[model samples]
Target: MAAIIAADHVSKWYGQVIGLNDVTLTVPPGITGLLGPNGAGKSTFMKLVTGQLKASKGAVTVLGEPIWGNPSLYFRIGFCPEQDAFYDRMTGLEWVTALVRLNGATEAEAAAMANRALDYVDLADAAGKKIGAYSKGMRQRVKMAQALAHDPELLILDEPLGGMDPIARRKTIRLIKEWGRSGKSVLVSSHILHEIESMTSNILLVNQGRILAEGNIHQIRDLIDEHPHTVYVKADQTRALARAFLSEDDVLSMKFEDGAVIVQTARPDTFYARLTALAASGELGAIHEVTSPDDNLQAVFEYLVKS
Candidate 1:
């Protein structure tokens, strides 16, 4: 499949600090989440793709064409910047219409496109409301609407769900999922693991200005499975559970705590499934909780860094 975006040995630096260090990645059609914590060069990579910033070394391409200083690429690309800055004087409709018109649409066409985009984001009711009067979620939807006004083939969203209530976040996630299912190239950057997990399995993980991992999240999980995983079980009888887990060959270590038993295992799913079956058989009574202590994006990132 043809890639919608490709970065080849892309590196960016400012003085002594590196922004992106020889990172290479490809984003194909469909939803691909860029997972990273803040200051992980996610924003810098986004800027490089949008031609807002130049890389000190290497190159980035959008839709097979180089992105830097390429205004022509804007016709097929939409970007929802992470910045909170916006013009408060204009109404939501006015704001989006202006951007659409700038992309070569006629004034009447811009109005039609803006209205359609607003309706898609469920912001039609607030079309006339000034941006200053809008809440954070409303502003987010307005930003989304502006990005979609041109109906671009590739949508680059940076922190799209930031500062939204649960309901708004749910709605936005659904919209992005739908867009991905329709086969548009959508690359969304987020620090939240579950947020990205809920959207798509295709992911690019970054940490400290470098690409750490890229592929199905399950592949990364498999790699971690080779390493020992810490599992925590909270229950009324910690000692009893710890004793039971120690008998298994997969369990590398066990310890008891305040009403809980923490076990280290080389095989997490197998161990967890066995424990579940044991509970069902009345062998472990009234099991309160079972969680993978090592099953998190931070842990995964740290494990890769150490490797």
Candidate 2:
């Protein structure tokens, strides 16, 4: 597959501080989650791609054209920034229409595009309301609407789900997923791993202004599979179960606490499945709760960032 965006030895700095260091990457079509905590240079990378800022060294190309200072690229790319800046007094329709017009669309075309973008974001009913009166979620959706107004080939969403309610976040995730499936290249950035996890398994992990890892999340999961996962199990039998788990090769370590057992294992799903089967078959009785430390993205990211 042809890469929509490519970076080679991309390095950026703000005087004494580094933003991205010797980073090289290729972003293919479909949804790619930009995974990193705050100050991880994710924003810098986005700016580099959108031509918002020039790279201190190296180069970035979007759609085979260098992104820096290229006005024409704006027609083929849409950006939803992390900042919450919006026209407080202007209605959503007015704001989006204004941006669409700035993209070189005629008044009628801009209005039609604005309406379609508003509808896509489920903000058509609130299009006439002042942005100041809109809720945070509404504001987020408005930002998304503005990004979608131009109908760009690439959608770069930086923390699009921030400040949204869970239901709204879910809807946004679904929307991005559908867009990716429909052949649009969607690159979304979020510090929250579960948010990125729910959107797409393809991730570009960044930390401390560098790319820590990139590729399928399951592959990264496999990379960390060797590390023992702390699985907490609360059951009626504590010592007996702990003893049983200690005898198994899959269970690397075990500890007893509060009438429950915390077992460390390399394969959580396998261990969990076996444990459940044992309990179901009247071998291990009365299991209550089972939780794995490696099941969440935060833990996995922490490990990778440290590595």
Candidate 3:
């Protein structure tokens, strides 16, 4: 399938600072997660795709058209920016209606579209309330409402779930998934790994203004698993549990803390199998919990970067 968005050797710089460096990738139809930490060029890439900023070098295209200087393309794309840019005095409905009007909708049409969008984001009840009076989550939802009001083919959501309450976040994730199911394309950026994982398995891992890895989340997890994994085991007989793993060749090192044994293993699968056997045999006493500190995005990125 042809790409919905494509970047060819893209790089963006601000004076001496580099925002994105020689990045090339294609976002296919449906939802694709842009995963990165703060200042990792996710926003720069988003801006480039959305036509907010011209690339200092290379090219970016959306829907087979160049993004920069493309006014007509705005009608086909919806953007929810990371930064909060709002008219605090304006009511949510009024703000969204004004934005939809920019797409050349009539006043009545804009208001109707805005109302539908607000309802989608669960902000319809607060549509008449001033934006300034809304809570952080409400403000976030209002931004989302404006983005969806136009009913664009592609959605560029930059931290759309940020500042949202847990319930709101889940609802927003479900909505994005529903959009993907409806065959609309979405490129959503977020620093939180589980948030992105919840929405889509396809991801682009970015760091230091570069594309580190891009593929199915399971593939990335497999790559991360090749690195040494740190697993914490809390048990009644921690020393006995630690002793059981000491004989294993895959076990690199072990330490004890707070009634838990921290085990570093090169082969986590092997280590886990052995752990399961020991627990089942009732030789290591009662196993309270087994947790891996290296199961997060930061650890995954660190392992990937180092490798």
Q: Who wins the TM-score comparison?
A: 3
Candidate 3, residues 236-266, lDDT tens digits: the string is 8988777788888899899999988999887
TM-score of 1: 0.75
Candidate 3 has an lDDT of 0.85
Q: What is the TM-score of each candidate against the true structure?
A: 0.75, 0.75, 0.76
* TM-score: the better of candidates 2 and 3: 3
Off by over 4 Å in 2: 219-302, 305-307
Q: Pick the winner on TM-score between candidates 1 and 3.
A: 3
| lDDT of model number 1 | 0.82
Candidate 1: minimum summed lDDT over ten consecutive residues — where? 288-297
Better of 1 and 3 by lDDT: 3
lDDT of 3 at 163: 53
Candidate 2 lDDT over 142-216, as tens digits, reads: 999999888889999998977664345556888889888888889998875556777888899987888988898
After superposition, which runs of candidate 3 have C-alpha atoms over 4 Å from their true positions? 222-296
Looking at model 1, residue 175 earns an lDDT score of 92
Candidate 3 pairs with clashing backbones: none
Alpha-carbon deviation at 286 in model 2, angstroms: 37
C-alpha root-mean-square deviation, each candidate: 9.2, 9.5, 9.4
